[model samples]
Target: MKILVTGCAGFIGFHLSKHLLEENNNVIGVDNINNYYDPNLKEKRLNILKKNKKFKFYKFDICNEDKIIKVFKKRIDCVIHLAAQAGVRYSLENPDAYFQSNLKGFYNILINSKRFKIKHLIFASTSSVYGNQKVMPIDEKSDITNPIQFYAATKTSNELMASSFSQLYQMKISALRFFTVYGPWGRPDMALFKFTNNILRKKQIDIYNFGKHKRDFTYIDDCVNAIKLIIHAKKKRKKFEVFNIANGKSEKLEKYIKIIERELKLKAKKKYLPLQKGDIQTTSANINKIKKFVKYKPSVNIETGIKKFIEWYKFYYYKNGK
Candidate 1:
């Protein structure tokens, strides 16, 4: 299969692209390598992917319609769109970036995907779209009318747009609502990385929502595998489908921090703070829908996941006291 993967340099994109390449699939990669966190990390992930002979890369933003069209011209069979401005708090500071990348950027990908008749278009959505649900184990049928964050709002918009496009063009589109995914080469902006970095440096790690927030933290490998299965799902799926790709378990914020501390063998100086704007107290996903569709089950537990991340983090950033 010839697959076009946007944001190939990103945390999830890098892992997914590597997985696809290992499966002997021809992967055409695209990423703007924006400095949302650090372009250096993105570069590192991209460099690894470039080592694969079956992988081809294009350095450009998905918002560039003309250039994106050129990539689709490569006789691409499918697309895995993971490129987007991703962050809840960052959305509060710079909403324009989110609009440009998540809104306009995804719009370009969606339209061009239809024009080229790409099969099995799988894109990354987020569990944030469910907002602060009163129900436990938030499912695909939850009411997502009220997204507290602009990032979630944009992702929710993406799902609606996908639903419309799939129905209109009879396009086979699947949106995976990812939970709090963490692993080696994970985004530095995310919780696990930030906590690990700060703890090792003996810096105070801020615990949000007064250390009471719960999140369904999914491992990178499991998340990527669920995507791989969906890409080649043997069953006929609905034109537009949504799945919650998660660990099927929720861990509290403080509990998550303790895991990091245990793995690092060091205590972290913590400061409890009220939930910031666009922050939710809890995010739990009902992954049964995805399990039914693709037999998707997240295998990595948080204990081992954090240990793996700590090893990678120490090797990458916690060395030489730099």
Candidate 2:
């Protein structure tokens, strides 16, 4: 299968592209390579992907409708649209960036996908869409109308746009509600990466919400594998469907920190603080829907996941002098 992956240099995108390429699929990768966090990390991810002769990457923004349409004309089989402005807190700082990429850029991809008669268009969503619901486990059917954060609102809008496209044109589309994804080659903006970096350097790590937050963390490998399974699922295609790609184990922030400490064998100097605005206190996923659809099983526990990340972080920075 020929797969088109947007945000190919991103954390999840890079891993997914690698997985798809390993499965013998010709991958067409695209990224603007913006400096949201650090382009160095994004560049490193791309460098790894470039080793594969089957991986074809174009350095361009997904917002460029002309260029995007050109790529769509390349007889693409499926589009795993992962390019968008991510980060919940960052959305608060720069709302315009979110609108341009998440809304405008997504529309570009959607229209092109529809115009090209693409087989499937699977885009990324967030568990943050389920906002501060007074519920335990969030499902596909949960109320996403009340997104606490601007970032979540953009993703919720994406789901709605995809739903309309799927219904109107009978386009095959899936929205993946990814929980707190973390692991090797993780985003430096993410909490795990920041925590690990601070702890290793003997700096005091800030704990938000007084370390009371709970998150359904998803390992990078498991997240990539689940996506691969869904893409290859032989089930009758639905016009629109949503899946929860999560470990389904909502662990507290304190416990998560403990695991990091254990893995690094270094005590973290902690600075507890109130939760920032646009932050979810807790997130848990109800994955029965995804499980029934693709037999999705998240194998890595948080402990092992953090360990793998720390190992990669050490090697990536220390050995490579990154």
Candidate 3:
């Protein structure tokens, strides 16, 4: 299969691209390599992917219609669009970035995919779209009307926009509402990486929401595997089928911290702060639809995933002398 994976330098994108390449798939990966946190980390991931012969990469933002269209001129089989402006808090500081990348970028991908007549278009969405829903296990049918942050609002908008395109263009599209994804080569902005880095450096770790928040911390491998399954799953051109790509488990912020602290063998100096705006109290995904369709079952638990992350983190920082 010839697959086009956007955000190929990103945490999940890097892992997914490698996985597909290992299976002998021809993968053309792209990323603007924006310095949302550190472009160095992004470059490291891209370098790893570039080592594979089956993998090719282009450094361009998805918002560039001409470049994207040129890439589509090839006989592309499917698209795994993961590029977007991530981070709920960052969205508040810079809403326009989200609009340009998440919204406009998504628009370009959809238009090009439709023009190219790609078979399947799987894009990334976020659980933040659920807003402050009191529900424990969020399903695909749950209401996503109340988005507390601009980031969540934009992600929800993406789902709606994708649905409209899918219906109008008769394209097969699936939006995966990813939970708190974490593991090796994970985003520096994510909680796990931040916590681990701070703890390892003996720096203070911010315990947001007074250490009361709970998140469905889905492992990176599990999330990527679910995506791989979706890639091959029969795509019936339904009007925007959305699934919560998660482990269906929730872990409290404090517990997750303890695990990281233990793994790093360091005590974390913490500052407990009130819940920030756009932050949800809890997120647990109901992955029934994905499971029913693709037999997707997350194999990694929080403890095991954290262990793997810590191992990688140690190696990474040690090699870098940080």
Candidate 4:
């Protein structure tokens, strides 16, 4: 199978593309390599994928309809759309970025996938879509009309838009609601990466919500594995579907930090702070549907996942004396 993965230079996209290539499938990856965080990190990820013979990469923004159409001229079996302006706090600052990438860019992808008669369109959604739902273990059927953050609003819009596309064209679309994803090659903006760096630097780490937030931190590999299983599922494809891909275990923010500190043998100077706007108090995923449909199992625990990430971080960053 030939898979086209947008945002292939990104954290999840990079891991997913590498996994697909390992499965002996041809992977065509595309990313604009925007400096949302660090283009250097994105470049490093792309360079690793370039080494694989089964992988082909394109440098283009997904929002460019012409370039996206040009890339689809070749047969693409399935498309895993992961490109978007990510970050809740960032969205509050620049709402236009979310509109452009999440809304406009997604529209371009959907139309092209429909134009090419693609079989499965697997796209990334977020647990943030749940948006203070007043419940634990959020399900696919949860009320997502009121997204607290503009970023979540864009993703919720993506789900609605994708559903319309699926219905209109009878397309097989899967919107994966990813929980707090963390692991190796993670974005510097993410908590795990920032906390690890701060702890290593002996800087004060800001503990949001007075260290009371609980998140279902899904490991990158586990998240990618769930995606692989869903894409390769032999069942008759549904016209539209949504699933929660998560570890199914909610861990406290403080505990998460403690594990990282233990792994690094460095205690972090903690500064408890109030939760910022556009942030949810808790997030837990109800992944029963995903498991039932695709036998998806999240095997990586938070401790093990953090250890792996720390090892990679040290090797990738510390070796250079940065």
Candidate 5:
């Protein structure tokens, strides 16, 4: 399959692109490589992908309609749209970035996918859209009307837009609502990376929501595998659907930190802090809907996931002398 993957340098994008390439698929990857966290990390991921002969890359933002249209000119079998301004707290500081990238950029991808007559358009949404629902283990039918964070609001908007496009133009689209994903080459802004880095450096790691928050922390490999399965799953007769690509288990923030400490074999200086704005108390996914659709089941546990991440973190940082 010839697949076009946006944000190929991103944490999930990098892993997804690599998986597809390894499966002998022709992949065209695009990313602006913005410095949301560090462009160096993005470059490192891109470099690895570039090593594969079947992989092609473009360093353009998805908001660039002309460039995106040019890429769509190729016979693309599917498009995995993972590019977006992602972060809850960062949304509080810079809402426009979210509007431009998550909203406007997504608009470009949707229209172009239709124009190209792509068979499947798989896009990344977030569990954050659940918006602190009173219910446990959020399903696709959960309330999406109230997104506490602008980041979640934009993602929710993408879901609506994708559904409308699918119904209007008979486009096949799947939105995967990813839970808290972590693993090697993960984003620096994510909690696991931050905690690991601080712990290794013997610095104080901030525990948010007073260390009471619970999260469905999905491993990178598990999340990528779910995506791969969905790409090849029996297509639903419907033009649109959403699935929760998560671990199907929630772990406490306090316990999460302890696991990291144990893996690092070092205690972290913890600083407890109240929940910041746009933070949810808990996020757990009802992945039965996904399982039914694609036979998806998360295989990596948190303990193993953290150990792999720690090994990568130490090797990468120590090699770089950071």
Candidate 6:
């Protein structure tokens, strides 16, 4: 199958593209290579993918409708759209970036899909869309109308746009709401990365909400596996589906920090702080709906996941002098 994967330079997108390429599928990856964090890290990821014969890459912004349409003119089989301006804190600082990438860029992708009559479109959503819902475990049927952050709001808008496109053009679309995704090649803006980086440098790690926040940190391999299973699953016409891609297990922030400390055999100097605005107290995903359609079994527990991440981090930074 020929696949178009946007944000291929990103953490999850890079992993997903590698997985697809390993299956001998032709993959065309696109990314703006914006300096959201570090373009060097993004370039490193792209360099790894470029080594594979099955992978091709394009350096372009998703908001460029003409370029997107030109790419769609090819015989593309499926599209895994993962491009977007991520980071809740960043969204609060720069709301226009979210609008430009998450809204306008999303519309450009949808228009291209409609124009090209693509078979299936799987896009990234977020668990943040659930907001501060009183529910313990969020499901597909849960009301996602109240997003605490602009980032979450943009993600919700993507889902609505995809649904509208599905209804109008009979497109097969799936909006995957990803939980706290953390592992090797993780984003520097993410909590896990920041904490790990701080701990390794013997710096104080900021413990938000007095270390009371909980998150269902899904490992990268499990995320890629779930996506691979969904890609092959049969799709019905005009089916606009949403699924929670998570471990379905919520681990407390302090507990996670302890695990990381234990894994690295180094205690982190902690600075407990109040939770910032647009940050949720907890996030838990109900994956029953996804399990019914595809065998989405998460393999990595938090302990093992953190261990793997630390190993990768040590080798990536220490050995490579990154």
Clashes of 6: 0
Give one digit per residue, the lDDT tens place, for model 6 in 1-322: 9999999999999999999999999999999999999888899999999999989899999988888987887789999999999888899899999999999999999988988989899999999999988988889899989999999999999999899889988899999999999999999999888988898889999988888999988999999999998899964433788989999899888899999899888999999999899999999989998887887899899999999999988988657655
Q: How does model 2 fare in lDDT?
A: 0.93
Give the per-residue lDDT of model 3 (tens digit) for 114-135. Answer: 9899988999999999988886
In terms of lDDT, model 1 sits at: 0.92
Residue pairs in steric clash, candidate 1? Answer: none
- With a 3 Å backbone cut-off (N, CA, C), the pairs that clash in candidate 2 are none
lDDT per residue for candidate 1 within 172-205, as digits (tens), equals: 9999999989999988888898888888888999
Cα lDDT tens digits for candidate 5, 64-179: 99999999998999999999999889999999999999999999999999988999999999999989989898899999999999999999999999999999999999999999
lDDT of 5 at 98: 97
lDDT per prediction? 0.92, 0.93, 0.90, 0.93, 0.92, 0.91
TM agreement with the true structure for every prediction: 0.98, 0.98, 0.98, 0.99, 0.98, 0.98
| Stretches of model 3 off by over 4 angstroms after superposition | 235-239
For each of the candidates, give the backbone clash count. Answer: 0, 0, 0, 0, 0, 0
Per-residue CA lDDT of candidate 2, range 103-165, in tens? 999999999999999999999999999998787898889899999988999999999999999
RMSD of each: 0.9, 0.9, 1.1, 0.8, 0.8, 1.1
Candidate 1: 10-residue stretch with minimal lDDT: 313-322
Instruction: Name model 1 segments beyond 4 Å from true.
Output: 320-322
Provide the global lDDT of candidate 3 against the true structure.
0.90
Off by over 4 Å in 5: none
Instruction: Quote the positional error of residue 27 for candidate 6 in Å.
Output: 0.3
